[model samples]
Target: MKKETLFIAFSTQKGGMGKTALTVLMASQLHYTKGYHIGIVDCDYPQHSIGEMRKRDTDLVMKDEYFKLQAYRQFSTLGIKAYPIKECTADKAIDMAEELMQTSDKDFDIIFFDLPGTLNSPGVILTLASMDYVFTPVSADRVVLESTLQYATMLNDNLIVPQKGNLKGLYLFWNMVDGREKTPLYKAYEKVIAELRLNMLKTILPDSKRFRREVSDQRKSVFRSTLLPADKTLLKGSNIEELANEICQTIKLENHGNQ
Candidate 1:
């Protein structure tokens, strides 16, 4: 039997919301730490940041002794190579993913798409509609919140409620939360979101520069990488593990096994 693969995306109408970073982090965590086979379709068109990151990660692993040793140990022990990242336009993303699933030697549990940030991009709506689950990152900013709410409302009204596509759930989660921010602001937004009846994730990611770091020769431990799972030490207090756990539970994904 062909493996059943979940199509998921971390997306938002607004840009610089950490969608790409979250995608790579979650994919890495689930694939390496949780032993789930993974694939990534980089559909951000002109940028293809995830695909580029993969190239840079590969280079770093080759040049850096620490990263090289880590990669060797990981692959040697797991008996699996790094997950594949395919690049394509928004319109061709689904087709590319399907082809990848059919052709890949390993059975994938999930295939993530890093989509274009703007809705004006060709096939953005179509791609978003096709996901089994869509997770949007929101912040405390007024403009970001407004844009996200409008975009979420549009998806809820047009695709989700009408059952137009494969979308099973649309989730919004707080991202880039600062400890210094007033509590009342978050409470107010939570009340508003509740009134709007949108699904919100319980896990909120705190603002940290670590999210921007990937496989680099300068860093002693990796926080984010396309080839390796995050270092266990860095996961403490990061809440990324919590977010991953919640997402897996929400999606009804079985643990399968872990390395």
Candidate 2:
């Protein structure tokens, strides 16, 4: 029997939303920590960061003895695969996704898209509309929150609502949340969240140097990194685990055993 594959994208209309990093983080956590078969489709056009990161990761594992051992234990026995990144035009996104989702016993159970952060790109609308779910990460900045809400509304009105229950959905989650107490920005966000009735996720990723220090000029996600001090290590691991679990529950994917 052909297994079902889940197609999801970490996307937003505005740039600087950490969409690419989120994709890599989610893919790594779900595959390495949670034992799911995962792959990434790098469709970020001119600069395919995730694709480049995959190459860098492969090289580090091969050449650096310490990195290799750490990565090997983290990955353990499950296979983690990444398809070659493509410079796919928006017009070709659907075809490319369909090609990637051809399921078999050895195929990926989940495939993530690292899309360019714009709707103007060719086929972007069509490609985004075709996803099983689109997960948009937004910060507390007024401009970003407003734009994200507008984009979410557009997706529902244009793609999901009119499709007569094709079951596609859009989700919003807070990214880069700071540790400060109830600030005006967060209060404003809560107001909008309630007003829009958006499918807000429960996982809020706190602002941390772990995300920045590890991701900068490197291919290692925190999910596969072994160099963190004890405190940051525990915090990062907890956050990643909670976020991964929330995602799986939201998407209704069974925690298939170590495949």
Candidate 3:
């Protein structure tokens, strides 16, 4: 495992499924709590959701007490930053990514790629294989899950991830999960979970209005207690952050052991 470079590509071959939200949340969590020097290469330029997200984040920090209040009066203390990577050609993307990895600041610990959703995009295949891990966020619906499963299948058919000394699988996780009781949507989610447990992480990000509200106005995750309460129903767990910790620890394990 590359200690400092846990690169994750958040893509689902489908749009409006909370891919941006999950990527931003994971990046923020890594930066704020675990202290990872993180970089987001927003491949979706012109429609740069991640870059605009960073702006919203800075804006939120200026107005809200959600983020850490630095001793300095300026609200520029948050370290999360984003840059727009050019077109989706595999060679160009791979080269740019490698250069960023090597030349990044000493504090940089993780890198995230916000890839465009379409698999037919010029460089998506290479981008998918290049990642050490992947977080594919699918909503609890059939069309969303079907589109996501296809990407997993595509990645599996072509990529060989070197984990430890052996090849391993890519990690997958469900996002925008609605805690419905045995509904059709829930059943659909269950099917994918059974098929990809090895690739899946156990933590679930429940669907919540807070996620939408913050994304619209605040433009960051609602993880910290200052922005959201520990037991906030919007997050919908015993504790709001309880599931988030599950994801970090699960990914930090020695290996997935399935592949």
How far off is residue 231 in model 2, in Å? 11
Candidate lDDT scores, in order, read 0.91, 0.69, 0.56
TM-scores, one per candidate: 0.97, 0.84, 0.70
| Candidate 1 residue pairs in backbone clash | none
1 or 2, which is superior by lDDT?
1
| Candidate 2 C-alpha lDDT tens digits along 170-201 | 88888888778466767678778778767888
Candidate 2 clash pair list:
90-122, 90-123, 91-123
Question: 155-225 in candidate 1: lDDT tens per residue?
Answer: 98899999999999999999999989998999999899888879999998999998998877777789989
Q: Mind giving the per-residue lDDT tens digits that candidate 3 earns over 43-73? A: 7644777666556655765676534353132
- lDDT: which is higher, 2 or 3? 2
Top candidate by lDDT: 1
- Candidate 2 residues lying further than 4 Å off, grouped into runs, are 72-87, 103-105, 164-167, 181-185, 215-238
Count steric clashes of candidate 3.
0
Error of 1 at 234 (Å): 1.4
Q: Which candidate is the best by TM-score?
A: 1
Sorted by lDDT (best first), the order is 1, 2, 3
Error of 1 at 2 (Å): 4.0
